[model samples]
Target: MSQDPSTEVVARELRGNILLVMINNPPVNALGVAVRCGIVAAIDAADADPAVQAVLIIGTGRNFIAGADIREFGKPPLPPSLPDVCNRIEACSKPVVAAIHGAALGGGLEIALAAHYRLAATDVKLGLPEVQLGLMPGAGGTQRTPRLIGAKAALDLMLSGRHMGAEEAHALGLVDRLGHSNDILADGLAYTQELLATHAPVRRTRDAQALSDRQANRASIEAVRAETGKKSRGLFSPLKIVEAVEAALDKSFDEGLRIERELFLQCLDSAQRAGLIHAFFAEREVLKAPETRNTKPRAIAHVGVVGGGTMGAGIAVAVLDAGLSVTMIERDEAALARGHAHIEKVYNGLIAKGRMTTDAKAANLARFVGSTSYDALAPADIVIEAVFEDMAVKQAVFAELDRVCKPGAVLATNTSYLDIDVIAASISRPADVVGLHFFSPANIMKLLEIVVPAKVSADVVATAFELAKKLHKVPVRAGVCDGFIGNRILAAYRMAADYMMEDGASPYQIDQAVRDFGYPMGPFQVSDLAGGDIGWATRKRKAATRDPRARYVQIADRICERGWFGQKTGRGYYLYPEGARTGTPDPEIEAIIDAERARAGITPRSFTNEEIMRRYMAAMINEGANVVHQRIALRPLDVDVTFLYGYGFPRHRGGPMKYADTLGLPKVLADIREFAKEDPLFWQPSPLLVELVERGANFDSLNKSE
Candidate 1:
């Protein structure tokens, strides 16, 4: 340990003939300027010392180095850039060994790749994940990774931004040795001593012949390019990563390094990079709300899930996977059996795919219990009711939970649209009643909307957020409303699509435009997958209270009347022939749209893809602004995080609110004013948006003020 406080971040010690240099930057040991300069000075001193035969580099904390200091992003360049420090280490006379424990990512992985040898713990994850931030690695990662591993492997790792385990790294020759012990220093020192005894030559990754089969690798590179182009349609960084890796094989190492730096700078200058970075920060920011930040969460261990249907089963699986005991309650013995089968089916699928062993499945299932009576849930710390979506049904379930569950046990409803406040008011203990709205296929999706009712206590809300963290779900606090955050915004935008279809655009054209805008699928396609019947039901439910003067399109209802629900029914707006997953456009839907337009006495007009997106995004942003203005969402970033995680709002655009801020709120308000001439009711700009535009402020201003 260093006695001097100034030099404490990087400490050096001599262990016999080998020099041990450990980076002491806490948390993730990010590669800031100070750490970079410290490593450079330490390496220079190690080379000058006559007694030191080799050098071993490791981190003092959990991670070797996670990445660059993100706080320095979008700032002026500092002295001793990461690439410069990497070059200095690579050119050192003595062999430098990198001992990676937790993560070696981005600039961290680049530093490791530049070392003479690499050793990693068995659970360590290594990657160049800069593409996730809309930038390729700049510190010679593109040039050095391909030289250590083949060109195809390096391109895949960089493009997908996926982490590789230590065993996989060793198999790919990226890590020279795999350490079994948790002590990274001991394993690294043993390897260093063995290398010195064997008189092993210093292995420079830049001089390696890993990419010898350039022609054969070119085919795979082309395949990956086509795949990335399809998957990452509107993104800039993945393609840039492909270019950088291709240069690695086709050009000299120094030339490849130059190309990587140039492409990385280009990504940095792009707007997509800004949006992605905002998205990265906004996810963490959404959890810092006042309700949950200061309050301590109630302890929760055992979870009770009511219902064994799709959503209920998925929630059960999620809780069980989080290492909490689960008790599933159903109404009867047959229903309990069905729920048990549903849980078993999920594990059985994983077993058939060789993703899980029989023992692991058995162990996971052992933590799960199924009962037909609600009395079995008496011991649960939290009980979530995933019953039907009707108000009466949810009320009855909560009443039963109130009677059977223990005092202080959290009682939650998973209703997507029904008013949670009504459900809370029906129960005697309203403080325990909150909404834990998990999206469809809850185990797979990451978003969890925590709906806070007027009667719910602060600690209960805090407990829900704590449970979200335990389940590895992104929890967004939402005030109790019809659809809360995601579904409410979704309803607004879907209506916009409907109005566009009646006015000018075809459903297929609108969907195609949305896909072009960066979403994996368009609104109509998502409707088809989720079953068109769901929207039909919501429309029918609201028809009794809907404003008569408000323009309402009946095309979807007309289709639902014909029993063409969606993928499950084999027919919808699109056709899914022979049980196929993807759908083809149906002419009948166009006829229905035309008939609806004729009934409304409207002339059809042509809408370009750009126009469609303008209208689509305007409605989304307008509704998101309302969500923030109404305090349904605590801040604008909360709305952004909700959509980014739940809905297929593209991460590259940084969700609707962030995208609106990037486009300038004044421009968005202007677009809304322009559209209001056609339909005054729907296109009326949000008051907060109009107020912000007049005050020369932005939605981010609201985020910061909150």
Candidate 2:
């Protein structure tokens, strides 16, 4: 059979009465225009050929189809859209069987739903994850998914944007069968032949009766809408997804598709969509560090973690989870035992949650070795020190690591604010030293700031990135500095929050405003959760170097002085009565604030939530710009990714840098300049922000240049 001249993305070959239609687009087979056209052309050809009685569609490589081509985002729609292609596939006279493997998501799932039958490989992952990109399914996904699976299941998959295993998909009736064989094509061909032999009829998902129970479907739709409303407060696409699913249950298939397309277009035009798409692309872009371009990562089989405090134990757990053998060291045997217990507790919790088997936990722990001796780490490929934040303590730890580690072994310090250069200088081998700043709860947090000191080798940086990938973490290359990227910017913004708190706004009001702006929690809430003492300690450390001209907010220090160190102490800006996870506003804290205001001789004024956020975002963006300008971060997107993954920066608003770009550089600069009138030293505009505003450029332009 002759291939379509328009595109080569789809190839067709006749296997007896079955015509094999293969998606040849490599690297996840994104359903771009060419692929769409190719599929429609192949379907037409198959229908016209009398020799073809059944059709089997499969992808060439690892994935069947990942999703719509990200490259096509923000571009004008091309002819033979995904919806048209899906409709054509469903309308084909010959029965079509979709054999899915490796990430059949979004448009990929839609295409599968359009087929008469779907056979998924045992390892296949299926989902409609368009809600993550701030868009609902534009094709027939919304309409067909609920018709194939139940309404509740379809909505759950789409809203959560979570992947389901092949068995789950088969159980949900999204897939007809699950293939156990390793060879996908063999299994697919055999399944297709079975269908032909049985004279299977075309079973369009749109014609299915999965959503036949009107009353039940309505209840499920309403239930999902209520849950989504609470969970996705500022998000736009989730509610739209609910609406589309509702349309599927209430309206005809074609009418439901029409509504889906309209809602999809609405989401496409939303600012949230722009921000989310930027976030999606920025994540991939941030992984490309200059050091990783040509340099190969050193093989890391065994890891050593120094110290067994919370941070240390967390890092050890993360390392062990990455399938690396870990040797954890503490100052004494008791501390080592505590660290071992901490690791065991995490696995035990997983077992209790049914997420892990006891056998699996035992097997993972078998690779772990806890010791009090520094000599135990001699066989380690890389040693990460997660001891105290004090410089002298870190220097001593690095000295031990330098002396004990073998040649070319990566010696990493997991310090949040300390200078890696100073730590490297203290060590004998500075070339092998790098800073790996893992956020609190390292095993769960996704961000890993790979802080590169001047003396560290490129291979070491590359190895850090490789390690991050193995740990299922997002790696951002950061130049050595106080707090590196995320925390430094965080300090600036948190200072902004402190300024607002002292100026007029209550901590609760400021927190509420921050929440309204899209963060999962307010700055004060995060401070409480992380323990206010952490920041207080940081403040005390910088006190000697802190500029006297800058306005200092003593409210936190006053609170800490009372031994009210946040959630742990049950009292901070908010009171955590009975160790409640959520805190309530404390009237006594207000009394403290009033006393501080009286002492400072400041007349407090009311501030709106909008005003509060304006200052908060201005501080964050200015510091982010300064980070990019000073080369602490390679690009603006690096800052964006760091905040998005590390900090609780809202993913829907994108990161601080992307938010700045979306909010307009001029507006942010204007806000900074205006705030400068009150606190010039604190509100000083970033030179980079000024330059970008003057040149009519945005942070994204800097990202593109990089």
Off by over 4 Å in 2: none
Question: What is the per-residue lDDT of model 2 for residues 600-654, given as tens digits with 9 covering 90 to 100?
Answer: 9889999999899889999999999999999999999999899899888999888
lDDT, model 2, position 152? 95
Clash totals, every prediction: 0, 0
lDDT, model 2, position 702 = 90
Candidate with best lDDT? 2
In candidate 2, residue 697 scores what lDDT? Answer: 92
Backbone clashes in candidate 2 total: 0
Q: Tell me the tens digit of each residue's lDDT in model 1 across 1-706.
A: 2323445677888999988988988889998878887888788878899988899999988899999998798899888988899989999999999988998999999999999999999879899999999999998998999888887889989988999998889999999998978889999999999999999877888898888888877887788899999888889999998898889889998899899889999999999999899889888887875678679988999999999998999999999889999999998999989988988998899899998899988888999999988899999999999987789988999889989989899999999999988989998999998999999889889999999999898999999999999999999999888899999989888999999999989999999999888888899889888888888888889989999888899889999999999899998989999998999999988899888899999999999999998889999999989998999998999999998889888999888998998999888899999999989998989998989999999888887787
- Report how far residue 422 has shifted in candidate 1, in Å: 1.4
C-alpha RMSD of candidate 1 = 1.8
* Model 1 poorest ten-residue lDDT run: 1-10
Off by over 4 Å in 1: 1-7
